[model samples]
Target chain A: MHELTVDLGDRSYPIYIGEHLLGESRWLQPHIPGKQVCIVTNETIAPLYLSRLKASLDGYQIHTVILPDGESFKTLEVVNRIFDGLLESRHNRTTTLIALGGGVVGDMTGFAAACYQRGVGFIQVPTTLLAMVDSSVGGKTGVNHPLGKNMIGAFYQPYCVLADMTLLGSLPPRELSAGIAEIIKYGLISDYPFFEWLEQNVDRLLVGDQEALAYAVERSCRNKAEVVAADEHEGGIRAILNFGHTFGHAIETAQGYGNWLHGEAVAAGMVMAADLSWRRGDISADELARVRDLLVRARLPVTAPDDMTPARFVELMGVDKKVLDGRLRLVLLEAMGNAVVTSDIDTDLLAETFAACR
Target chain B: MHELTVDLGDRSYPIYIGEHLLGESRWLQPHIPGKQVCIVTNETIAPLYLSRLKASLDGYQIHTVILPDGESFKTLEVVNRIFDGLLESRHNRTTTLIALGGGVVGDMTGFAAACYQRGVGFIQVPTTLLAMVDSSVGGKTGVNHPLGKNMIGAFYQPYCVLADMTLLGSLPPRELSAGIAEIIKYGLISDYPFFEWLEQNVDRLLVGDQEALAYAVERSCRNKAEVVAADEHEGGIRAILNFGHTFGHAIETAQGYGNWLHGEAVAAGMVMAADLSWRRGDISADELARVRDLLVRARLPVTAPDDMTPARFVELMGVDKKVLDGRLRLVLLEAMGNAVVTSDIDTDLLAETFAACR
Candidate 1:
């Protein structure tokens, strides 16, 4: 197992990446500060890994709530069921909540823990490739709204995140590819050397090469940890991490959550962002082609859906959280390995880029 | 206007108490970091004060969400409406939420702001005495679950809190007296001098003596500000601030919310606490009588309702947020002016206290 720490002072927590970690009491036991344990998982994952975790947490007063899987279920009302179970089981402020599933389960459970009794101790046991490299590491826990993705939520950090790579063995091909998009994001945002490594190992990553997967997950988390440490609340630099998210959220919301995988949408969003960046003269045509080539080879979408018009995309992106002072502050690429969040975009360029993507 | 600060490092905010604060853009405009502002109020306060505040906040992209009045409306579904309004209005992360009602409105709005896009800027414009002295000062914002009061919430601080004393002119007699219950709480927790002052000045406060009322409000806020600043998240000293809350919450939840004003339930809860403390030899019978006398004179209920059985109170209080591990922590008066949260209590003493209260 490899370990990394997100240095957030009093809220700092460790991220453990390894194979077969679900049953390892060493990683799961220490963080729980209380006797009552509530493990929230999805229906798909419950049959696969619930018993393994239950064995690890054997001596505690354990409880489990299996929710229906999908991003569409990420609502306050569904999250309320987790709260209801906690209350019914008589879980107190100190009861530890274990989020044992993919990104959807992790996000909903993290939010449930955050709101339950005004916050409680929680451990993130991410089972999917997307969740292990992204959602589980950061403390950004929340649910999505009908009008927007992740519209209502909290920045409540978890006690720790346990990323068991063996759990990813069960992820479908498209799901695994979606997680790789985020892994690719870490490189695009700041590390050219890592981006080059990913480009070289793309084939190995796709064919279930465990060593390649481990390296990519570790590097992505390192990048995530550094950025999260510098700005826990996204005051400045953390916004760079949303390079493709502004466009991607629009895709996810417009397409209806769960209709398109988050990674697939983000992959397409990154291509659109690259196109916009090139139009603004920030990146050369060669760089934009390199970004698009990567997404296409990874078997992810590289363009907007046929149903989306420039106007619809613009309207949806208009309400994203990145908007500041009534102007959209987008995380745009300055180069292949660098990005910046700026509202200074040429009106014609933005419109043309959307038209091109559509 | 009299102002005091809750010193929580960078998250610190000011509490402004005076007459007619809604018109003062000097205090409102600075904390608002964005052009968008959403005023969240209930049906009772919207018609009386919304237009007045809107006039002061001229030139901003303002929106309003007026909810049904009362504690019964404090649910996740109801709070979701506030989120829906913000999204429908296209308000982004920088949008500022100003809660312009009593404790229910303030708590729901603060929770909404705390969760809207993982938090946004929020200001509290308290229109009730209970809110001014208690809810608005501390950053404890949440909604109620059927099983418990404040079972779901976040400790998110607002940018600032505005307490308009003149708004109290419209408050009913029972509501004003209920607010006094929390005012009395400040004294019982750690201020015998303030307790003595309230005992002597209860009649003046009840009769709407502005000078006396101002003194009581300011004093209550000072006490609240100190406790909140010391603990922030209720790790230790802050729990003392919840002296009467356990029994009070049981009273509130048992009778169904809105039936007993929060402060009214707390008033009876305090008497029950005093009765328990006296039984344990922590206070003299005379001291207990003094506590009961003030509550009776304030026109607040000094005992639990006749219908609540000891078993029911125990069952309800068992699920409260304060329950740590399997033990229930009761905040008992150590003396006339000091209190402590202790899990150490005799079983018979607790049952007898419940019997006595019933």
Candidate 2:
């Protein structure tokens, strides 16, 4: 197993990445200090891996809240059901809550732990590649609102994040591609060689290459942990970590969440960002083309849907968290493996970029 | 205006206590830097004070979401409405959320700020006595779940808290008395002299003595701010602030929230706690009498509602945030003003205390 640390002083925790780490009972034992443990999973994941996870949690008083899977159900109403499970089981602030599914389950479960008795213990065992490489490491836990995705949530960190590579073997190709989008994102934001590495291994990753997958997950988490530690609350520099999210979240919002997976939207959003960057003279057309080529090779979308108009994008993007005062701030790539948040885009230029992406 | 800092490093905020604070542009100015503002006030409060609050936020573009007033409406479903208002208004992370009512408003708004776009800026313009002294300062933001009060929420603090004492003049006598319950709590937890001062000036407070009210509000906030700064997440000493809340929340739950005001239920819960303390030999009967007498003198309930059974109390208290694993922990008075949380009372003794109080 490979271990990476998210240095958050007293709240600091480790992320364990490797093959079949889930089968290692040692990983589960240290995090589960109390007798009462509530494992929150989803219907899709529960049948595939619940028994093994439950067996690892043997000798503890366990309760399971198996939610119907999908981004569609990520709402406060669904999160309330988690409160019901904890209360009915008499789970206290000290009780450990284990999130054993994808980003939706991890986000909901982490949020449930954060709000259950003001806050409680949470351990993220991310199953999907999207979660393992992106959402799972950060303490950003929340549910979706109809008006926006991840609109209602908290910056509550987990006790640990266990990303087992064996779990990736069961992920569908479409889902695997979605995860690749985020893995590629890590390269774009902070790491040049990592971006180059992802460019080379894109096909291998899609084909379920264990070595390539493990390296990508570890590198992504390392980058994510550093960024999260530096700016836990997005007061300043942390906004950079949200690379293509402003445009991505708008796409997710415009499509009415669940219609587009977060990573797929993000993949298209990155293209939009690249287009905007190219228009702004921050990146050459070649760099933008390279970004598009890599995403295309990874089986991710490289353009916004035809239906997503510039006006619709503007309307949806206005509600994004990154919008400061009223300006739409976006993370545009300055060069390969580099990005900067710019709110300086001209209206005609932004509309032109949106038009190009569409 | 008297200012008390909650001293939480970078997340610390100032609590301003004075008459007509809501009308003061100075308090609102530094906290609200952005052009967008959302004032969340309930229907009951909006009619009385919304315009005055809006007047203070003059230069900023402000939107209002008037929630139906009641503890029952303090749910995620209701909080979603606030999100709709912000999204509909195109409010972003820079938009400041001003909570303009009592505990419910502060909680929902603070929580909305915490969850809206992962988190945003918020300011508290508390009108009620309960809010001015206790709820607003501690940064405990959340809505009640059907299974538990404040089961869905965050520890997100506001940029500033503006407590306007003058608003108390228009408050109903019962609501005013509810505020006194928390004011008295600060005394019970850490200040014996404050308790004695209340014993002497309870009548002046009930009759609307501004000087007496101001002193109580300032003192209560000071006590609360100190505890919250020391243990922000209730990991240890902070739980002491919830001296009677376990029982109080149970009362709220058993009576179906809004049946008993939070402070009224807490008032009764404090009395029950004192009764339990006396039964546990932590305090003498006279001390217990003094506790109940102060509550009565303040026109607060001093016993559990007759309909509440020991079994019901046990069940409800079991779901309290203070409960560890499955054991019931109660904060009991040890002297005139000092208190300690103990899970050591005999079951028979606890039953006797419940039966006696009921």
Candidate 3:
């Protein structure tokens, strides 16, 4: 097992990445300070991993809230079920909530932990590659509103994140591709060497090679942990981590969530961002092409939904959280391995990129 | 006018106590860093002070979400209205949320702000004495659940708290009494001198003496601020601040909320706590009598509702946020002026106090 710490000072926690780490009491027990444990998993995951996890938590007073699986279920109302189970089971403030599913389950469970009795201990045991590489590492936990994705949430850190690569053996092909989108994001944002490595080993990740998957997860977490530690609240440098997210959120909001996977929309959104960067004379056409090529090789979408228009995208993006003082702050590439968050977007260029990408 | 700071390190904010501070832009504008402002108030408060508060932000883009007035409306569904309004108006992450009512409005707005786009700027403009002296000053913000009172919330601080004493001119007598319950709590928990002062000036406060009310508000805020600063997340000493809350929450939950005003429930709960303290030999019967006498003088309840039984109270209190590992941690008065949180409660004595108080 490989251990990486997201150093957030007093709120710092560890991310354990390796094969067959789940069902190990050693990895899960140390973080749970109290005797009561509430494991929140989705219906799909419960059928597969719940019993194994429950077995690991042998002595504790255990409770489980199994939710229906999907991005559509990521709402305040759905998250309330976890709250309902918690209150019904009489889970106390000291009780630790274990989020044992994909990103949706983790987000809702982490958010439930955040608001449950004004914060409690949370452990993220991410099951999907998407969660292992992205959502589970950062403290961004929340639900979606009809108006926007992650519109209601909190920057609440978890006690620890346990990412067992063996869990990915059962992931659907599309979900695996979706996870690679975020993996590619880490390379594009700040790590040039990792970006180059991904170019050579993108095939290895696509085929579910455990070694490559572990390396990508660990590297992505390391990059994310650094950004989060420096700016836990997204005050400055952290906004760069949202590279492609502003456009991706608009796509997700426009397509009605669940319809388009977050990473798929982000895959396409990254292309639009790169195109805009090329138009702004920040990066070469070759670099923009290379960005799209990596995502294409990983079998992720490279364009917005055919029905979405530039006007619709603009309207939906207006309500995105990234907008500040009525200006849309787009995270664009200054270079292949660099990202910059700027509100000063050339309207003509944005329209051009939207038209081209769609 | 008096200014007191809730020293929560970087998240610290000032509590301004004065006459006519609400209609002034000078106090409101300094805290609002963005151009957009969403004023969240209830129907009763909107008709009264919303316009006055709006008038202060002459140059800013303003929005209002007027909720139905009452504790019954303090829920996730109602709080969603604030989120809907914020998104509908395109209030981004930089926008500030101004809570322009009592504790219900404050709690809902603060929770909305805390969750809106993963936290945003929030300011508390309290109109009720209960809010001004207690809820608004502390960072405890959330909506109540059917299972328990304040079972879901965030410890998110406001940018600043503005308590306009003049706003109290229109407060109902019963509401004023509710506010007094918390002020008396400060005296019993940490400030005996303030407790003694309340004994002499309770009548003046009841009659709306501005000078007496101002002194009480400042003193209560100081006491709360000190506790909150020392332990912001209620680790140890801060639990004492919830001296009457566990018992009080049971009363509120048992009555189905909004029936017994929060302060009234707390008043009765404090009396029961004092009775329990006496039984435990922590305080004298005379001290318990003094506690009851002060609440009665303030026109607050000195006993739990006649309909509630010990078993029901026990059931409700068991689900309270204070419960740790199924153990009920009651904040009992160690003396007239000091409080201690103990899980080692004598159940027999607890039932005796519940029987005696009811």
DockQ by candidate, in order: 0.83, 0.67, 0.86
- lDDT accuracy of residue B269 in candidate 2: 89
Q: Model 2 — TM-score against the truth?
A: 0.90
Off by over 4 Å in 3: A250-256, A304-326, A344-358, B247-256, B279-282, B304-326, B344-358
lDDT of 1 by residue, A93-208 (tens): 88999999988899999899999999998899988899988887768889988877788888878888888777878899999999999988888988878988988998888987
Q: Compared with the true structure, what per-residue lDDT tens digits does model 3 show for residues A252-340?
A: 87887678888998999999999999999999988988998999999999999888898788777663334535467789888878888
Highest DockQ: which candidate? 3
**Highest lDDT model number:** 3
What residue pairs are clashing in model 1? Answer: none
Please list the residue runs of candidate 2 whose C-alpha ends up more than 4 Å from where it truly belongs after superposition: A244-261, A268-272, A275-290, A303-326, A346-358, B245-256, B275-289, B303-326, B346-358
Model 1 residue B163 CA deviation in Å? 1.4
lDDT of 2 at B37: 93
Model 3 chain B: ten consecutive residues of lowest lDDT: B317-326
Candidate 3 backbone collisions, by pair: none
Q: Which sections of candidate 1 miss by over 4 Å?
A: A249-259, A279-285, A305-326, A347-358, B253-256, B306-326, B348-358
For candidate 2, the per-residue lDDT at A17 reads 86
Better of 1 and 2 by DockQ: 1
